[model samples]
Target: MSSWEIHAIKYADRNARVRGDSFVFDDNHDAPHPMDYFMWLLRRGEEVILVDTGYDDAEAAARARPIRLDPVVALAPLGVRPDQITKVIVTHLHYDHAGGLRLFPNATLHMQAAEMAYATGPCMCHDTLRMPFTADHVCEAVTRLFSGQVVFHDGDGQVAEGVTVHRIGGHSRGLQAVRVRTESGWMVLASDAAHFYENLFARKPFPIVVDVQDMLDGFDRLLGLASRPELIIPGHDPLVCKLFAPGVADHIRRLDPGPTGKVPR
Candidate 1:
Protein backbone atom coordinates (compact mmCIF):
# COMPACT_ATOMS: atom_id res chain seq x y z
CA MET A 1 0.00 0.00 0.00
CA SER A 2 1.13 3.54 -0.80
CA SER A 3 0.21 6.62 1.13
CA TRP A 4 -1.13 9.57 -0.90
CA GLU A 5 -2.44 13.11 -0.62
CA ILE A 6 -5.20 14.13 -3.01
CA HIS A 7 -6.25 17.66 -3.74
CA ALA A 8 -9.25 19.04 -5.63
CA ILE A 9 -7.85 21.94 -7.58
CA LYS A 10 -10.35 24.59 -8.58
CA TYR A 11 -9.12 25.66 -11.98
CA ALA A 12 -12.19 27.20 -13.54
CA ASP A 13 -15.89 27.53 -12.91
CA ARG A 14 -18.88 27.20 -15.20
CA ASN A 15 -22.64 27.09 -15.03
CA ALA A 16 -23.03 23.66 -16.60
CA ARG A 17 -26.28 23.46 -18.56
CA VAL A 18 -27.60 20.03 -17.74
CA ARG A 19 -30.86 18.45 -18.86
CA GLY A 20 -32.71 16.67 -16.08
CA ASP A 21 -34.56 14.38 -18.40
CA SER A 22 -31.41 13.60 -20.30
CA PHE A 23 -29.65 12.41 -17.16
CA VAL A 24 -32.65 10.23 -16.35
CA PHE A 25 -33.80 9.40 -19.90
CA ASP A 26 -36.86 11.56 -19.37
CA ASP A 27 -35.86 14.33 -21.86
CA ASN A 28 -38.42 16.64 -20.27
CA HIS A 29 -36.76 17.94 -17.12
CA ASP A 30 -34.05 20.51 -16.38
CA ALA A 31 -31.04 20.20 -14.08
CA PRO A 32 -29.52 23.23 -12.47
CA HIS A 33 -26.16 24.61 -13.51
CA PRO A 34 -23.23 23.18 -11.59
CA MET A 35 -19.54 23.98 -11.05
CA ASP A 36 -16.58 22.80 -13.14
CA TYR A 37 -13.21 21.91 -11.58
CA PHE A 38 -9.72 20.43 -12.01
CA MET A 39 -7.65 18.04 -9.87
CA TRP A 40 -4.41 19.27 -8.34
CA LEU A 41 -1.45 17.48 -6.83
CA LEU A 42 -1.10 13.98 -5.40
CA ARG A 43 2.10 13.68 -3.41
CA ARG A 44 3.50 10.23 -2.67
CA GLY A 45 7.11 9.86 -1.54
CA GLU A 46 9.51 11.46 -4.04
CA GLU A 47 6.93 11.57 -6.83
CA VAL A 48 4.44 14.40 -7.26
CA ILE A 49 1.57 13.55 -9.58
CA LEU A 50 -0.63 16.19 -11.09
CA VAL A 51 -3.96 14.99 -12.39
CA ASP A 52 -5.04 17.83 -14.71
CA THR A 53 -4.02 21.41 -15.40
CA GLY A 54 -6.94 23.74 -15.40
CA TYR A 55 -7.47 26.23 -18.23
CA ASP A 56 -4.77 28.70 -19.15
CA ASP A 57 -5.66 32.05 -17.64
CA ALA A 58 -5.34 34.14 -20.78
CA GLU A 59 -7.21 31.69 -22.99
CA ALA A 60 -10.01 31.27 -20.47
CA ALA A 61 -10.22 35.02 -19.93
CA ALA A 62 -10.22 35.74 -23.65
CA ARG A 63 -13.38 33.74 -24.06
CA ALA A 64 -15.01 36.62 -22.12
CA ARG A 65 -16.84 33.98 -20.18
CA PRO A 66 -17.49 34.15 -16.50
CA ILE A 67 -15.00 32.05 -14.53
CA ARG A 68 -14.93 31.64 -10.79
CA LEU A 69 -11.14 31.47 -10.52
CA ASP A 70 -7.86 30.91 -12.31
CA PRO A 71 -6.14 27.56 -11.65
CA VAL A 72 -2.60 28.90 -11.63
CA VAL A 73 -3.57 31.62 -9.25
CA ALA A 74 -5.39 29.06 -7.17
CA LEU A 75 -2.12 27.11 -6.81
CA ALA A 76 -0.29 30.14 -5.44
CA PRO A 77 -1.48 29.53 -1.90
CA LEU A 78 -0.08 26.01 -2.03
CA GLY A 79 3.31 27.14 -3.44
CA VAL A 80 3.26 24.52 -6.23
CA ARG A 81 5.26 25.64 -9.25
CA PRO A 82 4.49 24.21 -12.67
CA ASP A 83 7.96 22.74 -13.16
CA GLN A 84 8.00 21.01 -9.80
CA ILE A 85 5.46 18.48 -11.02
CA THR A 86 7.19 15.13 -11.73
CA LYS A 87 4.29 13.44 -13.51
CA VAL A 88 0.98 14.55 -14.97
CA ILE A 89 -1.82 12.03 -15.44
CA VAL A 90 -4.16 13.37 -18.08
CA THR A 91 -7.62 11.91 -17.52
CA HIS A 92 -8.58 12.87 -21.06
CA LEU A 93 -7.62 15.27 -23.84
CA HIS A 94 -10.44 17.72 -23.52
CA TYR A 95 -9.37 21.37 -23.48
CA ASP A 96 -10.18 21.61 -19.79
CA HIS A 97 -8.11 18.52 -18.90
CA ALA A 98 -5.06 19.00 -21.11
CA GLY A 99 -4.69 22.77 -21.50
CA GLY A 100 -1.91 23.26 -18.97
CA LEU A 101 0.65 20.80 -20.34
CA ARG A 102 3.15 23.52 -21.11
CA LEU A 103 3.37 24.57 -17.50
CA PHE A 104 5.43 21.56 -16.49
CA PRO A 105 8.38 20.98 -18.78
CA ASN A 106 10.12 18.34 -16.66
CA ALA A 107 7.01 16.26 -16.02
CA THR A 108 6.27 13.06 -17.93
CA LEU A 109 2.60 13.03 -18.99
CA HIS A 110 0.49 9.88 -18.62
CA MET A 111 -2.45 9.73 -20.97
CA GLN A 112 -4.59 7.21 -22.84
CA ALA A 113 -3.42 6.35 -26.36
CA ALA A 114 -6.93 6.59 -27.78
CA GLU A 115 -7.37 10.05 -26.30
CA MET A 116 -4.32 11.36 -28.08
CA ALA A 117 -5.56 9.91 -31.35
CA TYR A 118 -8.99 11.44 -30.93
CA ALA A 119 -7.70 14.91 -30.08
CA THR A 120 -5.43 14.97 -33.08
CA GLY A 121 -7.19 12.58 -35.45
CA PRO A 122 -9.50 13.09 -38.41
CA CYS A 123 -12.64 13.25 -36.29
CA MET A 124 -11.43 16.68 -35.20
CA CYS A 125 -11.92 17.88 -38.75
CA HIS A 126 -15.58 18.42 -38.01
CA ASP A 127 -16.33 21.68 -36.23
CA THR A 128 -18.95 20.11 -34.03
CA LEU A 129 -16.51 17.52 -32.70
CA ARG A 130 -13.58 19.95 -32.41
CA MET A 131 -15.59 22.63 -30.67
CA PRO A 132 -14.86 21.16 -27.22
CA PHE A 133 -11.09 21.67 -27.48
CA THR A 134 -8.85 24.46 -28.58
CA ALA A 135 -6.68 23.65 -31.57
CA ASP A 136 -3.64 25.28 -29.98
CA HIS A 137 -3.84 23.10 -26.86
CA VAL A 138 -4.07 19.91 -28.90
CA CYS A 139 -1.12 21.05 -30.95
CA GLU A 140 0.86 21.60 -27.77
CA ALA A 141 0.24 18.03 -26.60
CA VAL A 142 1.28 16.74 -30.03
CA THR A 143 4.46 18.70 -29.79
CA ARG A 144 5.09 17.30 -26.32
CA LEU A 145 4.66 13.75 -27.59
CA PHE A 146 7.13 14.40 -30.37
CA SER A 147 9.54 15.77 -27.78
CA GLY A 148 9.25 12.57 -25.73
CA GLN A 149 7.54 14.20 -22.78
CA VAL A 150 4.52 11.89 -22.83
CA VAL A 151 4.05 8.27 -21.70
CA PHE A 152 0.94 6.88 -23.31
CA HIS A 153 -1.05 4.10 -21.60
CA ASP A 154 -2.49 1.47 -23.94
CA GLY A 155 -5.09 0.45 -21.35
CA ASP A 156 -4.97 -0.11 -17.61
CA GLY A 157 -1.54 0.51 -16.08
CA GLN A 158 -0.04 1.22 -12.69
CA VAL A 159 1.31 4.76 -12.60
CA ALA A 160 2.79 4.50 -9.11
CA GLU A 161 2.59 2.10 -6.19
CA GLY A 162 -1.08 1.60 -5.37
CA VAL A 163 -2.07 4.16 -7.99
CA THR A 164 -3.77 2.48 -10.92
CA VAL A 165 -5.29 3.92 -14.07
CA HIS A 166 -8.51 2.32 -15.32
CA ARG A 167 -9.57 3.03 -18.92
CA ILE A 168 -13.26 3.80 -19.22
CA GLY A 169 -14.67 5.03 -22.53
CA GLY A 170 -17.61 7.36 -22.09
CA HIS A 171 -17.00 11.04 -22.41
CA SER A 172 -14.13 10.23 -24.76
CA ARG A 173 -12.87 7.08 -26.46
CA GLY A 174 -9.83 7.02 -24.20
CA LEU A 175 -11.16 8.51 -21.04
CA GLN A 176 -9.69 6.89 -17.90
CA ALA A 177 -10.06 7.17 -14.13
CA VAL A 178 -7.48 6.93 -11.37
CA ARG A 179 -7.79 4.62 -8.37
CA VAL A 180 -5.51 5.23 -5.42
CA ARG A 181 -5.19 3.02 -2.37
CA THR A 182 -6.04 5.10 0.65
CA GLU A 183 -5.87 4.41 4.36
CA SER A 184 -9.61 3.95 4.37
CA GLY A 185 -9.50 1.65 1.36
CA TRP A 186 -9.55 2.51 -2.39
CA MET A 187 -10.71 5.85 -3.78
CA VAL A 188 -11.67 6.16 -7.41
CA LEU A 189 -11.09 9.44 -9.17
CA ALA A 190 -13.84 9.12 -11.77
CA SER A 191 -12.50 11.69 -14.17
CA ASP A 192 -15.22 12.52 -16.63
CA ALA A 193 -16.34 8.90 -16.47
CA ALA A 194 -19.30 10.24 -14.54
CA HIS A 195 -19.33 14.03 -14.35
CA PHE A 196 -21.41 14.21 -11.20
CA TYR A 197 -22.19 11.90 -8.27
CA GLU A 198 -25.88 12.25 -9.04
CA ASN A 199 -25.23 10.58 -12.37
CA LEU A 200 -23.90 7.52 -10.57
CA PHE A 201 -26.21 7.55 -7.53
CA ALA A 202 -29.33 8.15 -9.56
CA ARG A 203 -28.32 5.68 -12.28
CA LYS A 204 -28.63 8.52 -14.82
CA PRO A 205 -26.33 9.40 -17.67
CA PHE A 206 -24.96 12.79 -18.53
CA PRO A 207 -26.10 13.99 -21.96
CA ILE A 208 -22.72 15.03 -23.34
CA VAL A 209 -21.35 11.53 -23.71
CA VAL A 210 -19.54 10.03 -26.66
CA ASP A 211 -21.01 6.57 -26.09
CA VAL A 212 -23.99 6.26 -23.82
CA GLN A 213 -23.63 2.57 -23.21
CA ASP A 214 -19.93 2.84 -22.51
CA MET A 215 -20.59 5.59 -19.96
CA LEU A 216 -23.11 3.39 -18.22
CA ASP A 217 -20.73 0.49 -18.31
CA GLY A 218 -17.95 2.63 -16.92
CA PHE A 219 -20.13 3.64 -13.96
CA ASP A 220 -20.76 -0.01 -13.15
CA ARG A 221 -17.04 -0.72 -13.39
CA LEU A 222 -16.23 2.19 -11.11
CA LEU A 223 -18.54 0.90 -8.40
CA GLY A 224 -17.05 -2.57 -8.56
CA LEU A 225 -13.48 -1.25 -8.39
CA ALA A 226 -14.06 0.72 -5.23
CA SER A 227 -14.63 -0.66 -1.76
CA ARG A 228 -17.25 1.98 -1.13
CA PRO A 229 -19.35 4.16 -3.42
CA GLU A 230 -18.63 7.22 -1.25
CA LEU A 231 -14.95 6.91 -2.09
CA ILE A 232 -15.63 7.59 -5.77
CA ILE A 233 -14.93 11.21 -6.62
CA PRO A 234 -16.64 12.69 -9.66
CA GLY A 235 -14.61 14.84 -12.05
CA HIS A 236 -16.77 17.97 -11.96
CA ASP A 237 -18.64 17.72 -8.69
CA PRO A 238 -17.96 20.57 -6.26
CA LEU A 239 -19.15 18.46 -3.35
CA VAL A 240 -15.95 16.42 -3.37
CA CYS A 241 -14.27 18.49 -0.66
CA LYS A 242 -17.37 18.41 1.45
CA LEU A 243 -17.61 14.65 1.10
CA PHE A 244 -13.97 13.98 2.02
CA ALA A 245 -12.04 15.04 5.06
CA PRO A 246 -10.01 18.27 4.89
CA GLY A 247 -6.28 17.69 4.86
CA VAL A 248 -5.17 20.29 2.35
CA ALA A 249 -8.04 22.75 2.12
CA ASP A 250 -7.32 25.63 -0.25
CA HIS A 251 -6.10 23.74 -3.30
CA ILE A 252 -6.85 20.03 -2.70
CA ARG A 253 -8.01 17.72 0.07
CA ARG A 254 -6.38 14.57 1.31
CA LEU A 255 -8.94 11.78 1.06
CA ASP A 256 -6.88 9.20 2.94
CA PRO A 257 -3.14 8.92 3.35
CA GLY A 258 -2.84 5.12 3.20
CA PRO A 259 -0.25 2.97 4.94
CA THR A 260 2.45 3.92 2.43
CA GLY A 261 3.36 7.22 4.10
CA LYS A 262 1.89 9.98 6.20
CA VAL A 263 0.69 13.36 4.93
CA PRO A 264 0.41 16.00 7.62
CA ARG A 265 -3.29 16.65 8.16
Candidate 2:
Protein backbone atom coordinates (compact mmCIF):
# COMPACT_ATOMS: atom_id res chain seq x y z
CA MET A 1 0.00 0.00 0.00
CA SER A 2 1.18 3.51 -0.76
CA SER A 3 1.58 5.60 2.39
CA TRP A 4 0.91 9.31 2.12
CA GLU A 5 1.72 12.19 4.46
CA ILE A 6 -1.37 14.21 5.33
CA HIS A 7 -1.38 17.65 6.93
CA ALA A 8 -4.43 19.56 8.08
CA ILE A 9 -3.70 23.26 7.51
CA LYS A 10 -5.99 25.65 9.31
CA TYR A 11 -6.51 28.81 7.24
CA ALA A 12 -9.43 30.48 9.01
CA ASP A 13 -11.60 30.29 12.09
CA ARG A 14 -14.91 31.58 13.45
CA ASN A 15 -15.08 32.05 17.18
CA ALA A 16 -18.25 34.12 17.39
CA ARG A 17 -20.48 31.08 17.24
CA VAL A 18 -22.68 29.14 19.61
CA ARG A 19 -23.64 25.53 20.16
CA GLY A 20 -26.79 26.18 18.16
CA ASP A 21 -24.63 27.28 15.25
CA SER A 22 -22.84 23.95 15.21
CA PHE A 23 -25.37 21.33 16.23
CA VAL A 24 -29.00 20.82 15.39
CA PHE A 25 -29.98 19.49 18.82
CA ASP A 26 -27.66 20.84 21.46
CA ASP A 27 -28.98 21.50 24.96
CA ASN A 28 -26.45 24.27 25.51
CA HIS A 29 -27.58 26.17 22.45
CA ASP A 30 -26.29 29.55 23.66
CA ALA A 31 -22.85 28.32 24.73
CA PRO A 32 -19.81 29.25 22.66
CA HIS A 33 -18.51 26.77 20.09
CA PRO A 34 -15.79 27.93 17.73
CA MET A 35 -15.10 26.50 14.27
CA ASP A 36 -11.74 26.24 12.56
CA TYR A 37 -11.45 26.21 8.80
CA PHE A 38 -8.84 24.00 7.15
CA MET A 39 -7.51 22.78 3.82
CA TRP A 40 -5.72 19.42 3.84
CA LEU A 41 -2.54 18.61 1.88
CA LEU A 42 -1.62 15.04 0.97
CA ARG A 43 1.91 14.22 -0.09
CA ARG A 44 3.78 11.13 -1.33
CA GLY A 45 7.35 11.55 -2.56
CA GLU A 46 7.12 14.41 -5.09
CA GLU A 47 3.39 14.07 -5.74
CA VAL A 48 0.80 16.20 -3.92
CA ILE A 49 -2.99 16.15 -3.79
CA LEU A 50 -4.86 19.02 -2.14
CA VAL A 51 -8.14 18.10 -0.50
CA ASP A 52 -9.95 21.49 -0.44
CA THR A 53 -9.08 25.09 -1.37
CA GLY A 54 -10.47 27.45 1.25
CA TYR A 55 -12.23 30.70 0.26
CA ASP A 56 -10.17 33.75 -0.65
CA ASP A 57 -10.13 37.27 0.87
CA ALA A 58 -13.21 38.55 -0.93
CA GLU A 59 -15.24 35.77 0.60
CA ALA A 60 -13.85 36.52 4.04
CA ALA A 61 -14.69 40.21 3.75
CA ALA A 62 -18.15 39.62 2.34
CA ARG A 63 -19.02 36.93 4.78
CA ALA A 64 -17.42 38.61 7.80
CA ARG A 65 -15.09 35.64 8.29
CA PRO A 66 -11.56 36.58 9.33
CA ILE A 67 -9.56 34.11 7.28
CA ARG A 68 -6.00 34.21 8.64
CA LEU A 69 -3.88 33.20 5.63
CA ASP A 70 -4.13 32.69 1.93
CA PRO A 71 -4.12 29.10 0.75
CA VAL A 72 -0.68 29.69 -0.83
CA VAL A 73 0.74 31.15 2.37
CA ALA A 74 -0.71 28.36 4.51
CA LEU A 75 0.90 25.76 2.21
CA ALA A 76 4.28 27.45 1.63
CA PRO A 77 5.96 26.04 4.78
CA LEU A 78 5.36 22.48 3.52
CA GLY A 79 6.91 23.33 0.09
CA VAL A 80 3.60 23.09 -1.79
CA ARG A 81 2.64 25.68 -4.38
CA PRO A 82 -0.61 26.16 -6.22
CA ASP A 83 1.11 25.83 -9.57
CA GLN A 84 2.77 22.56 -8.60
CA ILE A 85 -0.41 20.95 -7.34
CA THR A 86 -1.39 18.22 -9.84
CA LYS A 87 -4.66 16.99 -8.35
CA VAL A 88 -7.37 18.32 -6.01
CA ILE A 89 -10.17 16.30 -4.42
CA VAL A 90 -13.04 18.69 -3.84
CA THR A 91 -15.05 17.24 -0.97
CA HIS A 92 -17.99 19.46 -1.83
CA LEU A 93 -19.04 22.79 -3.39
CA HIS A 94 -19.87 24.78 -0.27
CA TYR A 95 -18.14 28.18 -0.31
CA ASP A 96 -15.42 27.16 2.11
CA HIS A 97 -14.58 23.94 0.27
CA ALA A 98 -14.68 24.94 -3.39
CA GLY A 99 -14.57 28.76 -3.45
CA GLY A 100 -10.93 28.80 -4.44
CA LEU A 101 -11.33 26.39 -7.34
CA ARG A 102 -9.32 28.63 -9.63
CA LEU A 103 -6.34 28.74 -7.27
CA PHE A 104 -4.77 25.57 -8.61
CA PRO A 105 -4.77 26.42 -12.29
CA ASN A 106 -2.81 23.37 -13.38
CA ALA A 107 -4.49 20.67 -11.30
CA THR A 108 -7.28 18.42 -12.44
CA LEU A 109 -10.13 18.61 -9.88
CA HIS A 110 -11.82 15.42 -8.69
CA MET A 111 -15.46 15.86 -7.64
CA GLN A 112 -18.73 14.02 -7.25
CA ALA A 113 -20.95 14.15 -10.35
CA ALA A 114 -23.97 14.87 -8.16
CA GLU A 115 -22.21 17.89 -6.62
CA MET A 116 -22.00 19.76 -9.88
CA ALA A 117 -25.54 18.80 -10.71
CA TYR A 118 -26.78 19.96 -7.32
CA ALA A 119 -24.85 23.21 -7.55
CA THR A 120 -26.04 23.93 -11.06
CA GLY A 121 -29.39 22.23 -10.81
CA PRO A 122 -32.63 23.60 -9.41
CA CYS A 123 -31.63 23.04 -5.82
CA MET A 124 -29.55 26.26 -5.86
CA CYS A 125 -32.51 28.45 -6.69
CA HIS A 126 -33.57 28.80 -3.08
CA ASP A 127 -32.02 31.71 -1.15
CA THR A 128 -31.10 29.72 1.95
CA LEU A 129 -29.78 26.85 -0.14
CA ARG A 130 -27.71 29.19 -2.31
CA MET A 131 -26.22 31.37 0.47
CA PRO A 132 -23.43 28.91 1.21
CA PHE A 133 -22.12 28.97 -2.37
CA THR A 134 -20.58 31.73 -4.43
CA ALA A 135 -21.71 32.00 -8.03
CA ASP A 136 -18.21 32.76 -9.31
CA HIS A 137 -16.77 29.65 -7.71
CA VAL A 138 -19.41 27.48 -9.31
CA CYS A 139 -18.70 29.26 -12.60
CA GLU A 140 -15.00 28.51 -12.24
CA ALA A 141 -15.86 24.84 -11.81
CA VAL A 142 -17.95 25.09 -14.94
CA THR A 143 -14.95 26.60 -16.70
CA ARG A 144 -12.86 23.66 -15.56
CA LEU A 145 -15.48 21.26 -16.83
CA PHE A 146 -15.34 22.93 -20.22
CA SER A 147 -11.56 22.61 -20.30
CA GLY A 148 -11.65 18.98 -19.12
CA GLN A 149 -9.80 19.81 -15.93
CA VAL A 150 -12.63 18.46 -13.74
CA VAL A 151 -12.96 14.73 -13.13
CA PHE A 152 -16.43 13.66 -12.00
CA HIS A 153 -17.11 10.62 -9.82
CA ASP A 154 -20.43 8.89 -9.38
CA GLY A 155 -20.01 7.40 -5.87
CA ASP A 156 -16.62 6.08 -4.80
CA GLY A 157 -13.50 7.18 -6.73
CA GLN A 158 -9.79 6.68 -6.44
CA VAL A 159 -7.60 9.80 -6.57
CA ALA A 160 -4.32 7.93 -6.21
CA GLU A 161 -2.91 4.54 -5.25
CA GLY A 162 -4.06 4.60 -1.63
CA VAL A 163 -6.24 7.73 -1.50
CA THR A 164 -9.92 7.32 -2.26
CA VAL A 165 -13.01 9.58 -2.13
CA HIS A 166 -16.49 8.47 -1.18
CA ARG A 167 -19.77 10.34 -1.64
CA ILE A 168 -21.30 11.04 1.78
CA GLY A 169 -23.87 13.64 0.88
CA GLY A 170 -25.93 15.45 3.57
CA HIS A 171 -24.36 18.78 4.35
CA SER A 172 -24.36 19.51 0.67
CA ARG A 173 -26.18 17.60 -2.05
CA GLY A 174 -23.03 15.66 -2.98
CA LEU A 175 -20.62 16.02 -0.12
CA GLN A 176 -17.81 13.45 -0.06
CA ALA A 177 -15.11 12.19 2.31
CA VAL A 178 -11.49 11.37 1.56
CA ARG A 179 -9.95 8.15 2.94
CA VAL A 180 -6.16 8.00 3.00
CA ARG A 181 -3.69 5.23 3.74
CA THR A 182 -0.98 6.19 6.24
CA GLU A 183 1.73 4.24 8.01
CA SER A 184 -0.31 4.24 11.20
CA GLY A 185 -3.59 3.15 9.61
CA TRP A 186 -6.45 4.27 7.32
CA MET A 187 -7.36 7.90 8.11
CA VAL A 188 -10.73 9.06 6.95
CA LEU A 189 -11.04 12.81 6.35
CA ALA A 190 -14.63 13.40 7.36
CA SER A 191 -15.04 16.78 5.72
CA ASP A 192 -18.35 18.33 6.85
CA ALA A 193 -19.60 14.78 7.24
CA ALA A 194 -18.83 15.55 10.87
CA HIS A 195 -17.97 19.16 11.67
CA PHE A 196 -16.97 18.28 15.22
CA TYR A 197 -16.24 15.10 17.19
CA GLU A 198 -19.56 15.70 18.92
CA ASN A 199 -21.34 15.40 15.60
CA LEU A 200 -19.89 11.93 15.13
CA PHE A 201 -19.84 10.68 18.73
CA ALA A 202 -23.20 12.10 19.71
CA ARG A 203 -24.78 10.99 16.44
CA LYS A 204 -25.99 14.52 15.73
CA PRO A 205 -26.06 16.49 12.51
CA PHE A 206 -24.52 19.85 11.74
CA PRO A 207 -26.97 22.77 11.35
CA ILE A 208 -26.17 23.68 7.74
CA VAL A 209 -27.44 20.48 6.22
CA VAL A 210 -29.60 19.57 3.26
CA ASP A 211 -30.51 16.03 4.17
CA VAL A 212 -30.42 15.28 7.91
CA GLN A 213 -30.51 11.52 7.56
CA ASP A 214 -27.59 11.37 5.11
CA MET A 215 -25.44 13.33 7.54
CA LEU A 216 -26.35 10.84 10.29
CA ASP A 217 -25.52 7.91 7.99
CA GLY A 218 -22.22 9.55 6.99
CA PHE A 219 -21.01 9.47 10.61
CA ASP A 220 -21.23 5.69 10.63
CA ARG A 221 -19.67 5.64 7.17
CA LEU A 222 -16.71 7.72 8.39
CA LEU A 223 -16.17 5.38 11.36
CA GLY A 224 -16.40 2.30 9.14
CA LEU A 225 -13.97 3.69 6.56
CA ALA A 226 -11.23 4.22 9.08
CA SER A 227 -9.21 1.50 10.79
CA ARG A 228 -10.45 2.91 14.11
CA PRO A 229 -12.51 5.82 15.49
CA GLU A 230 -9.36 7.79 16.36
CA LEU A 231 -8.44 7.78 12.67
CA ILE A 232 -11.61 9.68 11.82
CA ILE A 233 -10.89 13.41 11.47
CA PRO A 234 -13.66 15.96 11.61
CA GLY A 235 -13.88 18.88 9.17
CA HIS A 236 -14.13 22.06 11.26
CA ASP A 237 -13.40 21.01 14.81
CA PRO A 238 -11.10 23.23 16.88
CA LEU A 239 -10.64 20.13 19.03
CA VAL A 240 -8.61 18.65 16.17
CA CYS A 241 -5.72 21.02 16.90
CA LYS A 242 -5.95 20.22 20.58
CA LEU A 243 -6.13 16.44 20.06
CA PHE A 244 -3.41 16.16 17.34
CA ALA A 245 0.10 17.47 17.70
CA PRO A 246 1.38 20.25 15.48
CA GLY A 247 3.51 19.47 12.43
CA VAL A 248 5.86 21.66 10.35
CA ALA A 249 4.06 24.66 11.93
CA ASP A 250 1.69 25.21 14.84
CA HIS A 251 -1.46 25.40 12.72
CA ILE A 252 -0.41 22.53 10.48
CA ARG A 253 -1.42 19.36 12.32
CA ARG A 254 -0.11 15.94 11.24
CA LEU A 255 -3.22 13.80 10.90
CA ASP A 256 -1.55 10.67 9.53
CA PRO A 257 -0.26 9.83 13.02
CA GLY A 258 -3.82 9.74 14.35
CA PRO A 259 -4.70 11.52 17.57
CA THR A 260 -2.17 11.95 20.36
CA GLY A 261 -4.70 11.36 23.16
CA LYS A 262 -8.37 10.87 23.90
CA VAL A 263 -10.77 13.70 22.98
CA PRO A 264 -11.45 15.94 25.98
CA ARG A 265 -14.96 15.78 27.36
- lDDT, each prediction: 0.75, 0.91
**Model 2, TM vs. native:** 0.98
lDDT of 2 by residue, 87-186 (tens): 9999999899987888899989999999999999998889988989999989998999999999999999898999999999999988999999998899
For model 2, give the 10-residue run with minimal summed lDDT. Answer: 256-265
Q: Which stretches of candidate 2 lie over 4 Å from their true place?
A: none
Could you tell me which residue pairs clash in candidate 1? 3-260, 7-252, 8-252, 21-27
Residue 123 error, candidate 2, Å: 0.8
Q: What RMSD value applies to candidate 1?
A: 4.5
lDDT of 2 at 175: 95
What's the TM-score of each model vs. the native?
Answer: 0.88, 0.98
Candidate 2, clashing residue pairs?
none
Candidate 1, residues 1-265: lDDT per residue as tens digits? 5667676776666665546623657454665656567665777766678887777776676665454566666666566877788788989888788877777788888889998888888878888677767877778778888889888888899899988898898778789999887767888889888787778877788766777898989989999888777778788876765655554445455666422322111
> Model 1 TM-score?
0.88
